[model samples]
Target: MNIIIDTVVKEYDNVTIDIDGYVPIDIKLVDSKGNPPLYWRVGDGSKSLLELAVLPENGFLSAITLVMMDANSIHKVGNNQVELSCEESGLPIVNLDLWKDSANNDFSQRFIDNFNCDMQVYISEDTILIKIIESDNVNWIHCGGGFYLGLNEEKNITHLLINSLTQVDITNFTESVC
Candidate 1:
């Protein structure tokens, strides 16, 4: 007797989907040798994990709280942006933008220009204002604003900011922080 079966495996690449009713839930950063670097959980229940595999040995990290949010309604920003209100004075808190155009993709500038709205991006404590000057021949995305935390001119602040915010178990922070 002989038996045979046919099967096919499907592979799907990760893509960014529009998040609805998402606010800022919590941000956590963790650093340890040979461990995953970053984990993010948005208020809309969207989540992602990023691993920095190429770091020096014996790296240690902890979450540094620059700002805190309202306790009762922690994750309710009306618009797509994760806006915040300052707890101290009841003022508007600027939400940090974490999205970036792919380095290999040259369509970012053109896309922004066609829209004609200033792209606001936040990295660490700084808000970056971006305007598309040209896209056809330029190789890099040139925009103004860098290093809100006031680092060295040559330092890769974007990388540091991203690393700091992305390395943690954010989904379980409510339990862990308690």
Candidate 2:
């Protein structure tokens, strides 16, 4: 993943903190009014502490880490929404805005907590890039997709454009998925 170090200051106090180049992702936090508060920021890329603490033996985020590239998209239930229609190819058209967040890493917990909808997590596997859809019960359902993780000409890590779920044949269910 590409690491671009950036700093953010608290909205109220302006206390700045350095976020070591985390990728920003757009997500919608659902509010009490059944509306999703749309916003963007660097997400917690590591496996959740809750997952680690609860399920020590399980690799809960292993599959997630695979499919979701650095610059991916997430949506929640709000205003000034950007429209991205999926083509017949079953892949969303590449839109850069959807991949970036407004505040970098200094995301607000209140904004997220106000939304009832769970955050969406995407992970690309060796071959299968899947969206880890969290169910009402917090169980995950794999929505398959594909993306490329590689180094660019400058030796900088970049996410190359790979196919999406519909384009990739993830049905093989074999070790050679990648």
Candidate 3:
């Protein structure tokens, strides 16, 4: 693919987006073994895994989240003179789930700025659509709020945008959780 997360970050070793409830979501763009700290956390300072709390903010959300992580695992978004000068590459999509109170779930609805594949191609020409790879968890459902006895298959939080669309399935991830 011609995309990997975004553009400014032209290279990376690996990329992993950890979506957990406690932290909500933590995007780690591991560029080098000891690239240096670009964010903050309570841990050692060996320097890998850039954690961008909020830079590529997205106002859109849906049952599925769209991101392009290529073989290089490096991607950048935006071309604005001002925006291009930013340090962070991307942020949690619709991650406004926090610092704004919680009670809803959302996913891809519109082309979100700052946090999508290079808009120049994906949204502009509308060519080379991003593909959903296997075993890549890409969905999150808040399921109204409150609590539950256990994570039912329906709300086990095990969903992915398969076939390029948001769909639920009974996978090992769900089975182990429930």
Q: What TM-score against the true fold does each predicted structure earn?
A: 0.16, 0.18, 0.20
What's the residue-level lDDT of 62 in candidate 1? Answer: 18
Q: Which stretches of candidate 2 lie over 4 Å from their true place?
A: 1-46, 49-126, 134-178
Please give the lDDT score at residue 128 for candidate 1.
19
TM-score of 3: 0.20
Model 3, stretches more than 4 Å misplaced?
Answer: 1-9, 40-178
Could you tell me the TM-score of candidate 2? 0.18
Error of 3 at 78 (Å): 25
Clash tally, candidates in order: 5, 15, 11
Error of 2 at 22 (Å): 10
RMSD vs true structure, all candidates? 21.0, 18.8, 19.5
Model 1 C-alpha lDDT per residue in residues 32-112, reported as the tens digit of each score: 345332212112121221111111122222122212122332221222222221112111111111213322334332111
Candidate 3 residue-wise lDDT, 39-79, digit = tens = 21111112111122222233221122222222233222232
Candidates 1 and 3, the one with greater lDDT = 3
Clashing pairs in 1: 30-167, 37-167, 38-166, 38-167, 39-166
Q: CA shift at 14, candidate 3, in angstroms? A: 2.1
- When summed lDDT is taken over every stretch of 10 residues in candidate 3, the lowest stretch is 143-152
